[model samples]
Target: MEKQIDNHYRYLQQHFSYLIRQQALLPGEKLPSERDIGERFNLTRMTVRQGLQTLEAEGLIYRQNRRGWFVSPPAVVYNPARRQSFIEYVSSQGFEPSTDLIGVTVNPADARMAELMKVDKGARLLFLQRRRSIDGRPVLIEHIYINTALLPGIEKEDMSQSLTHLLRNKYGQAYHSMNLIFKSTALLEDAARELGAAAGLPGLHIERTNYDAAGRVLELDYEYWRHDAVTIQIDVNDA
Candidate 1:
């Protein structure tokens, strides 16, 4: 029975995958209802859903709450090695970029944060939560911890604009370098909800520590990105 179910789901997966590849299902085009698909394929709704999920994991389709699934748009190319801000890189790729300030607060650093920032525990940090979108589709959630000691009064500035711009123009500081880590992980429930993605969906997790000319950590960034929304590309360095 298990083997039969697997075959059924694989068939369903291939059916949709082929159509999407042929462009019969264009970007932003909606797929048939799950019930409809199940009936048409003579499969259980669970099997139909399993197949659709396989396509989703492959970055071919996405679902919106109450609206059903739609063919995913082109993935935004992201270069972590590039020194470009999200707005800069995204716009350079010809996609519209926008940011929404989810919330901002000041919090005392914990032991782990202190170690990461090279600051004493209880040092105040400016925390910002932001949602970034491409072409009006929310794709990334940013949880940024700024060492306010390095860039005082930053909390007073507009939080929605690019922090890199603020750092350069007002504070006279820039991202001189960064320590970065990337992982493929399941999206946190809250982050998934914010991105309009399913809970526990696979996502790209990026942890970046931006530094100043003095090699001091300026900001620590935790980025959660929708799996289908972006692709990572790293240039080979001959040196």
Candidate 2:
């Protein structure tokens, strides 16, 4: 009986996978409800859900809260060596990009933050949180700690726009070097809640430290991304 059920679900999975690959179901297209799918396939709702879950795990589909499943868009390609801003890269890929400033404040640096920023403990740092969306879907949340001493009066600028642009245009500071680390992990409770994903869902975590021309730390950034939303690529060339 279990084997039969597994084959049944596999049939449904293959059916949908075909449609998606054929472009019969375009990206961001919604899938029918479990009841409808079950009725059409003569399978139980549980079986239908199992098929959909498989596709979701494979990054072919995703779910919105109470909105059912959707065919996922192509993953955004991120080349860390390129110095393009988020807006630039996202637009180059033919997707609309936007950012929402969730909060901004100046806070005294704690021990860990101070060490990361290479600043003394208790030094004031500008903290910013933002939600970044692509094609109208929220996919990444960013938390940034700015070294205020380097960019004095930065807090007075608009935080909703790209900080990279602000740094270049306003302060004449372009990114000189960066250290980055990426990890595959489960989303934390608060980050999941903000991204409308269930707590403990698979996610991608990125830690980045930006440096200035003088080799001083400019910012420390932590980013939480939906596992399906991005594909990281790096190019290697022999010097």
Give all TM-scores, in the order shown: 0.95, 0.94
Model 2, 30-115: lDDT tens digits are 99998999999999988898799788877889889899999999999989899888899999999999999999999999998899
Q: Give the TM-score of candidate 2.
A: 0.94
What are the clash counts of all predictions, listed in order?
Answer: 0, 0
Q: Candidate 2, residue 6: CA error in Å? A: 2.2
For TM-score, the strongest prediction is 1
Error of 1 at 8 (Å): 2.2
lDDT tens string, model 1, 1-239? 99988888888899889999999999989999999999998998878888888898899999888899999999988887788889999999999999999999999999999999999999999999999999888999999999999998988999999998999999889799888899999999999999988888899999999999999999999999999998889989789
Error of 2 at 97 (Å): 0.4
